[model samples]
Target: MKQAESVSDFYKRLPSHAPTAVPLDNAGIGHINVFSRETCSVVSPYSRRDFYKVSLIIGTGRIYYADKWIEIDRPALLFSNPFVPYSWEAESAEQSGWYCLFTEEFVQHSERMHNLRDSPLFRIGSNPIFFPDQVQLGELSAIFQKMQAEMASSYPHKYDVLRSYLHLIIHEAMRSNPAEHFAAYSNASSRVSALFLELLERQFPIDSPQVNLKLKTPTDYAGALSVHVNHLNRSVKEITGKTTSAHIAARIVSEAKALLQHTDWNISDIAYSLGFEYASYFTLFFKKHSGISPTQLRGVV
Candidate 1:
């Protein structure tokens, strides 16, 4: 996967005259920025972002996220996370919106905030687009309006208030978004399962000690594939008759055995190449699955 765009790059892409005082991300807000009446869509190249964004867009456009596309003819809210790549194309020239872009650390101080990646709005493979009803739209926009006001306020505890507002918006979105976003599970399961297997296979060979397995766990693969971890597990299990983690472990153990038998690299190097931080951890994992330690396997083979 390609590197995600950073919040600094995001600022540089904006118009030279974009408001410099809209709580720019590098300020004391801890890498969070807010904008209103930002008529231009500054997103480009259709790649992931290092920061998460929640946009209140009031225009007609096609939103491309992950492998899916959504058309919007009405006011909508969108959640874009660092885990997924996305971009937008406006069908109309006139655009009005509020957007808040913040890094994960900005709101990760609390237990609930730590689960941001697993939330309904930002979770991979979940519907991030929501078309609120007219009344709901007004309410949502009002919240953004307040956020803007709070960002520009002189209050010492404004960010604390901002956090509360952010929570409210997220909760409201999850509660109010329609349930029509789900596709047929059987169809979805097969498709996601195939993609998951392919992605799982692509990280193979571990040809060098310097190389690291990028997708080491089901959660890591879920983030890479832009699907919720539970959803990915369910789909893979239903389609393959085995848990996703089981498949991952089986493949890793297979490769470990082969590496042990074929290569003279030290166990620590092999462990590092296979995404383990320590040889002991990898040894434990290998012995648990193979009934022998890596050294024993190498000696026997």
Candidate 2:
């Protein structure tokens, strides 16, 4: 399990089976449905590499993220970039939904569509769910239908057609999205959260000891942000619904897992590198949050 460190690290663990979900043999993209309630209920913890996901709620239930639960009252759009990890908890086997997965390259390569980055839906470091009315949902679904049609059809410019339809979907989403939802985060609490998120993202892909410069404590962040420790925690908790220590620990745990998975470093090396005074202490901390020991994660078990 990857620790939910930076927001990007959170995203990197998003799990989906896009390869088998899509029907095309050489096609790099496709869509599928993930429904859970009884046995396969929990989405668990996983990440994505090259694909981005957009989900439309067709069944009824809750969507969990950001330490809070969002009720999916109606059909709505949920966006997950390649950088986040998300999961669902099930009381039973009663959840269902449609999830669309496509490669960034495919979406960006098709000609004349609005850039995916411009859609406001695909922006990095932001995760705002957009709820649409009946009329708008109908329009958006039409665009998706057209794209699916183009994918299935044998046309000279099928890819181009799909791009055009996708552009329409994005534009409709932009046109219909509630502007205030995006704007509400622009105030004080949001700014602090944004800064913290940026700081968290910068610590990753640490290639060496020099790269692991000590972001040693909460005060290091509070001092840099020019706010009292209490005030920083208050604002962050207000906006994000999690405590400062939780975020910090989460970030450290996230980085620790990434190193364990992607690097050849030993436990002591990783522990000292993350600023732990003792390897045993680091092991305990990692196990507490992630439910597994680092050594076991490295497959030495």
Candidate 3:
């Protein structure tokens, strides 16, 4: 597992010709940046990001989202949110498309602030992949091209114009499959399950040594969300097909692997930050979950 990529790191990884003139705000809100897949540099596998991304990928590729692997056999539209960890692996050498990345605050100035996260494009667990037709692909491509041009221009209201273009791409995707995209939770169980997942993902990346995970068990999460532990467990299991504890453990192991591979922290410090009281107990837990010790993984990486 790789450490999550920050927006600044992403900019540094781009090709020499890729523009970086757009200034990012103090809140880490970047003006919309567009890239052509052919020109952009490739990223490592299992890499996670801290920003939102929308891509129109053409050619063959595989998308790893959460635990699911989605194969792209044709032109497709993909949406990735900050909460979900996803990576793209290209199967074919010939790839071409457009992708734009921006932060949640980039669109906050718009009147449709509340609807941004509520939209299917940014919703976790909702299918973010779509196979678009030739005509639809052309339309989406044109919007991205316009955005690319606008991002390079010094127009006074370029950011505002870019917001409309972003919404256009989103609405176009929603229109492609309104039924699936607009599906809403009609029951309390489903809503609770969504909330639990959101709360669970909020404690992720463990980016700093000072930022320790506070929610380690289902009961801890239920207390935070003001729900019964049993009800939370049942809802998570019913909707996700996995127990709440399984999700928590898997996420912890994932973060542990990232920390072990990417950071210089000692094993004891890493263990304590992850909520383990002792280094020996963390070793036992990590070996049980990953079949390897933290030191072993660090050496391999």
Candidate 4:
């Protein structure tokens, strides 16, 4: 039930005197920070983060991604985006990895950034975990090392150089396995389905109490997407094998579970934030989907 960890929270969790030299900008162009696992504190178990993370891991571990648990046995390259909830548990005590955290705005300066959504790194359903051979690992490690060095440097345009390194790392991972890259959709159904999923995911994490979900039903999403409700439902069903309403209900339940478990907010506040007209109605909807009341789920958690 934990909320997503924000960028400021990330820095606060780090040890004092840990490298903290990131550019502060007003344009929402985010800063980048690189760290070796050995030098940083362990992230809390099952906690979610609100930024993008790319890591060159050198030891075995398991990453809980969304509903899937992926085991990593070899040197691996892992990418985590903001939408998916993930946590890492290292299997080896002697774990070592170089990870760089960046925001969506950090990479917007490059043309390749436009294709980021289609890349396995940011794609919702694609596998973000990959095993790399020694050569690939070494190459990736070198990129991280360069990024770390650049971060500590006093050069005026160091960020520009760092952005280039980031692009290099992204391109290297994409090239590592051509077969894993997501292909462009050639059909309208696939395109619509992908867009629908994207739109749905963008409303997630429910990070703040002041923020409320605006799209709650199939008709709402269809209207936003400029499509008939039936057409939207058909496309989502064709691609995902689930009805649009089912998907919406499932997502709402997931968020409800998170809010119940992670926050101190009362049932009424939670229900209102999720677009429920009344707390009783929210309880009924939650119980219908989860087989338990929200309060019960919170107690179990």
Q: Can you write out model 4's per-residue Cα lDDT over 1-301, one digit (the tens) per residue?
A: 3567777777767646244456434256676888887754344455567778898888777887665578889888888887777778877777787998887777776676755655776787678887877887888889999998988888978878888898888888888767647477868888888888778877876766666899999999999999999899999898889998898888888888877875788898889888898999999999999999998987887
Off by over 4 Å in 1: 15-29, 177-235, 239-301
Q: After superposition, how far is residue 215 of candidate 2 from its true place, in Å?
A: 5.8
Order by lDDT, highest first: 3, 4, 1, 2
Q: How accurate locally, in lDDT, is each candidate?
A: 0.78, 0.61, 0.80, 0.79
Choose the strongest candidate by TM-score.
4
lDDT of 4 at 52: 82
Which scores higher on lDDT, 2 or 4? Answer: 4
* CA RMSD of all predictions: 12.6, 8.7, 3.9, 3.2
TM-score of each: 0.61, 0.53, 0.77, 0.82
Clashing pairs in 1: none
For candidate 1, give the lDDT of residue 150: 86
**Model 3: per-residue lDDT, tens digit, 105-199?**
78777887445766777876578898888898999999999998988888988888888899899888889777876668878889998898878
In the range 191-262, model 2's lDDT, one tens digit per residue, is: 887777667655543445324536666678788888787877888898889987888898788778876775
Off by over 4 Å in 2: 2-46, 66-69, 88-97, 110-119, 177-196, 199-301
